[model samples]
Target: MVAKYVMLADTTRCINCKACEVACRAEWDTPLGYSRDWVKEVESVNAKGMPELQIFPGRCQHCDDAPCVEVCPTGASWKREDGIVLVDHDICSGCELCVPACPYDARWLNPVTNTISKCTFCQPRIDKGLQPACVETCVGNALIFGDANDPNSEVSILLKTKEWQRLITDEVNIGPNHYYYTAGKTIPVEVMPKLHERHLAGKSIESIVNPLGTIGIGGMMAVFLGAGVKKLVDRRKEVSEKEDNHEHH
Candidate 1:
């Protein structure tokens, strides 16, 4: 059986140094303004009105039922058997259709490649028997990565002994593999998953065009036709609303 790769983030140890973000950017050459990973710090008051802080190191959840993979017009966004979800640049259409499908907002269009880019757990380095850049450079040692299936692995040990949580929501449970050990602190608002926060661009099209029926040129034509009709309807509604306002005047 293939190893189940997972990450255990010890939020108690995170110092908000952002070394992980810098490491990922350096390793991937991620463009300015967009990166494959991030560190979020949320400050709030407890019930006693005392100030408290929580920090989260975040990336793609690499979900088992990834909405990005399900809504991909092409089979470009796919998951390997080992559970890493990746984008095949050559097969992607640059349609930005998968942009809105991720609840975690993990996927983005790479300006350089005109293809989707995201965190892959540094799969290349992992294949080379090295830790992910973020994990390697973590100054606080908050980030831990390894195959969760291996009993001796750090991730597996953490899972067995420590209480952990994911950024999962009750409404949108997708079987995310990332685990968080917060040491009983309230989860930061910045790190919790919000399904309504997902972009609507790709999701709107997916709602209208059935993926199973989209088989070839005929399906492509349906997308165009559906979009045209929607635009026309919106235009007519705008005109009618204008006419009603004019009459009221």
Candidate 2:
């Protein structure tokens, strides 16, 4: 089996310090009012019957079946061979079709570049044999990244031994690669991904644009076929009438 990269998040050990967020910003120099990654702080009662802050470090799920790649008409949004979902700046059209398609709210249009931007798993750093910035700066060492397919990798062993859970809902389970280890604790309901109303433009492309194109092509083929059959039938009938006239004569 090929190596599939995955990020294992030990939510129980997360300190909610936002170190990962800072590290990501610094590494990418992300613009103002947008971020590539985030730490979700959900205030709720913990297992101890006391109000506790639940932290979930979130980013692009790098799903095995990603919706962003599906809605992108330009084919700019694509997943890498190792499971990292990324957007190509040159091919992106700033149409924002991918924005609403993402259930995790991971994609956004860059205000500066006018292109789609999202977490790349720090692909450049990974290519250079270094870890992602967020994983490197995690204060609690909660974030673990490696090839899950490798038997010798730490993530592979942890996944085998630990009871890990994915943030998947019944309605929209796209096979996200991120894993969460709650350490016998229940996750807060607030942080779960909710169903988003798709944007009008994106909706039309799927519902109107594609179906219309198919219908148009099919309709044209049907018209030409009907005309050809009619002409052939007329020609045969005309020849039959001439043969009858000759016999009568």
Candidate 3:
């Protein structure tokens, strides 16, 4: 039995060229406005207090203790048989709730399809005995992928030999399967990109396309509210007219 797990990234080796992002887009035909994977450009303050830029390739961590799966009301999000966390598009209702539940911002609602999508660890390629698109396209060999459970596998060996750490936060312990080998104390936000505040500032259901079904719902709500208020005004007019008729009679 092959036990599936995650690969740790050695950030020191990454060149921030974004080959992984391109490969992912090409292979998946990701929409222009959204991506199943992303490369976050990070800038650190230099000694002169100027920003020094770096790039970090990020995707679904495929966490062992996944919070997205737990928070999802429909159970559309789940871990696959091989341990990769994935969303079942067939079951997803485009609620957009799971998007924020993910600490890594790994989940995204597809604007075209109106369903949630995220990284699947290239299960299709892995099943075919090929590396993930990102892993194969990495110019500097920065990304590595294999079974962490297998002691002889590349990922397992790397974890054992290298000083490594997992990205975590106290707020929500997602138990991210992705690991990192940075030569210093690990900060959760440092390993994961900081974009929640920005995302919150720009939050909207419009971020995900309004589906045909939802347009009716919105229209119905507006109509119902209008009719209810109009009915109340008409009732009040009727009562006043009845009192005047009774007095005249």
Order by TM-score, highest first: 2, 1, 3
C-alpha lDDT score of every prediction, in listed order: 0.85, 0.89, 0.76
Between candidates 1 and 2, the one scoring higher on lDDT is: 2
Q: RMSD of each candidate? A: 14.4, 1.7, 10.4
Q: How far is candidate 2 from the true structure (C-alpha RMSD, Å)?
A: 1.7
Which tens-of-lDDT digit does each residue in 136-247 have in candidate 2? 9998999999998899999999999999989888887889899999887676667676674477978887799989999999999999999999999999999999999999
Instruction: Estimate the TM-score for candidate 3.
Output: 0.72
Cα lDDT tens digits for candidate 3, 50-109: 876655677888877776786666899988766898888889998877777677888888
What would the per-residue lDDT of candidate 1 be over residues 1-249, giving only the tens digit for each residue? 698888778999989899999999999998889899988878898889999888889999889889888878789999988888988889997777777767777888999888988999999999898998999999999999999878998888889998999887788789898999988876865677767333475555555445545666677898999999999999999999999999999
Off by over 4 Å in 3: 46-51, 185-249
Q: What local lDDT score does residue 163 receive in model 1, on the 0 to 100 scale?
A: 92
Best by TM-score: 2
Candidate 1 positional error at 121, Å: 0.1
Give the C-alpha miss distance for residue 36 in model 2, angstroms.
Answer: 0.7
After superposition, the stretches of candidate 1 with alpha carbons farther than 4 Å from their true spots are: 196-249
lDDT of 2 at 76: 94
